[model samples]
Target: MNKKQETKYELILNAAFEQMKEKGFEKASISQIVKRAGVAQGTFYLYFDSKGAIVPAIAERILEEQLGLIKSEVKENDSIDRIIDVLIEQTFKLTDRNKEVIKFCYSGIAYYDSFQRWEDIYRPYYLWLEKKLEKAITTKEIAQRKSISHQAIFIIGLIEQSAENYFLTDEPKKDEELNLYKQDLYHFIKRAIS
Candidate 1:
């Protein structure tokens, strides 16, 4: 697509994201998204078949943004422990910031056509984490003889689930308590792998 098309595409996605956050995935209307994007309703159909079609784009965009932020913060020579710390911090920070969108994405996986495309949407992010874990093994930082894929999944799941529990679940936690939990979690994973 050209510059104008790309700009309008971004606008529509941004509008959809904002609308989903404000009104929720189920309630956010396509017309409002188009209107907020300043694009004709037909233009939305030109890019996306339905509101659900945009859900995967939202999920993909969130993952890519988080991955970029994490990559920028981590260096090639950083210790494995530092890498893990950065991953946990970045994942938690982004997940907390986008709780609404993340929740919507999960709902999309459950209810929309996104379930069939889950692997396609998330494989790159998962592979990136797997490679990071593989690097730790090669550097002799990770002593355990475990599958990098499993390790990556475990680490990512722990961080994401912890963030969800703190931000999206009904359980209440104070700032101090949350920080303590993060420290405990960081240490637990570090000891388990390294």
Candidate 2:
């Protein structure tokens, strides 16, 4: 796409992101997205077929941002425990910072098949973690296991669910209680895998 087209494309996506944040994926409408984008409705159709069609793009953007934050926190020589800590910390930080997007994605899963495309968007993170776990298992850093795929999936689910529960939930939590929960979560996962 040329510069002008690129600008319009970004405007639509950014507008869609904002709409999804405010109204949620299921309720966020194409017309609102186009209006917020300052583009004609026809322009939206040029880029996306429906509101649902935009979800995979949003999911990809959100996951990429989270992965970037996680990668930034880890050093080349970090130990498995340290990496896990960084992962947890970064995951919580991202969820807290982008709570609306996280909530939209989670809630969208209940309503939109496009939301299930997360597995594809998350493939890189999954493979990266799987490779790390495979090495750990081989070196006996984590317990030797034949089911690395299962283990990797468990780890992903653990982080995603825990972060959503603690950081993205509407439920109120006191600072002290939240800290304790985070510590407990860290220890629980550490013990489970290490």
Candidate 3:
């Protein structure tokens, strides 16, 4: 798309994101989005079919943004421990950057009955993690007691849970506390594999 079209699309999506955060996905409406965006109502339909369609777009954009960051950090030649650190660090970094979007995914959005759409955005990144686990298993960088796919799910779930815990708190604990939690988590995971 041309620059103008790209800009319009971004404007609409960003407005939608803000509305969704304030009113939630189920309550957020197209009219509100276009109004906030200062774009015509017709312009919304020019891009998205419905709020449900926008949901996937938000999820896809979120995943792509963070996955791009993560892809840069992981070393193809790095050991499993190093990769784990990279993965956890990238996960937390992205969580801090897009906490709203992350909360939306696990919040009322997940109950939308469009499970496939939610899964679509996550599948690519989850598959990438699975591939990494598979490679580590094959290279003996990590243990092979379980299937790499299962291990990937474990890693993804752990990251999500940890991040949710971190973001859900109000006081915002210190960096040292978070680091110690991560270290403990890593050792627990290592024990399972070792």
Candidate 4:
């Protein structure tokens, strides 16, 4: 599609999100999205099968965007701890601003029977972590674990678990406390692995 088409599709998706937030996901209407987007109702159908498609699409976009930050932050020669710290800090910061997006992720799974597989949407982070784990082992910085793949997966899963909490609960951490938590987590992971 052309740039104009892509822009309109994005606008429709953005409007759908606002409507979903204001009205709960199940109750958010297609007309509301179209009206808010200033798009003809027909235009929305041309882009998304339903508002459900937009939920996963938005999630996929977020993962892709954040993974780019990870790529730029991690240098080839950086220590495993530094790489992990970069991932942790950038992820926590990203999640702070995009709580609604993360909420929509879990809500997508709950509400949309047909939402895309999260693995497919989030493949880049998985692949990057896998590569880092491989390097850490070769450098002897990472101790042998029960399948490094599983460990790396678990680490990412832990962050996602944090994301869910960060979305749904009121964190008592002031900024300083949160920084300490990040440092503690980094040290814990580094010691646990290396």
> Best candidate, TM-score-wise?
1
Worst 10 residues of 1 by lDDT: 113-122
- Which is the better candidate, 1 or 4, if ranked by TM-score? 1
lDDT of 2 at 95: 76
Off by over 4 Å in 4: 1-4, 21-27, 114-116
Model 3: colliding residue pairs: none
Q: Write the per-residue lDDT of candidate 1 for residues 1-194, one digit (tens) a residue.
A: 99999998999999999999998899999999999999999999989988988988898899889889989998888888888888888888998899988898888767776676876766777798887777888888888565877777788778778877778887777889878878888998998887
Error of 3 at 152 (Å): 0.9
Q: After aligning candidate 4 to the native by TM-score, how far in Å is the CA of 40 from where it should be? A: 2.0
Instruction: List the lowest-lDDT window of 10 residues for candidate 4.
Output: 159-168
Checking candidate 2 for backbone clashes, the offending pairs are none
TM-score of each: 0.92, 0.88, 0.82, 0.85
* Total residue pair clashes for candidate 1: 0
- Could you tell me the lDDT of residue 111 within candidate 1? 73
lDDT digits (tens) for residues 142-162 of candidate 2 = 897778787777887788789
**Tens-place lDDT digits, model 4, residues 34-134:** 99999999999898887776777777777777888888999998888888888887788778867766776677766676444776776668878988898
| Deviation of model 3 at 120, angstroms | 1.6
Q: Deviation in angstroms for 125 in model 1?
A: 2.0
Which model is ahead, 2 or 3, in terms of lDDT?
2
Please write out the lDDT profile of model 3 over residues 2-44, one tens digit for every residue.
9998898999989988898788776888999999999999989
Please give the distance, in angstroms, between residue 119's alpha carbon in candidate 3 and its true position after superposition. 1.7
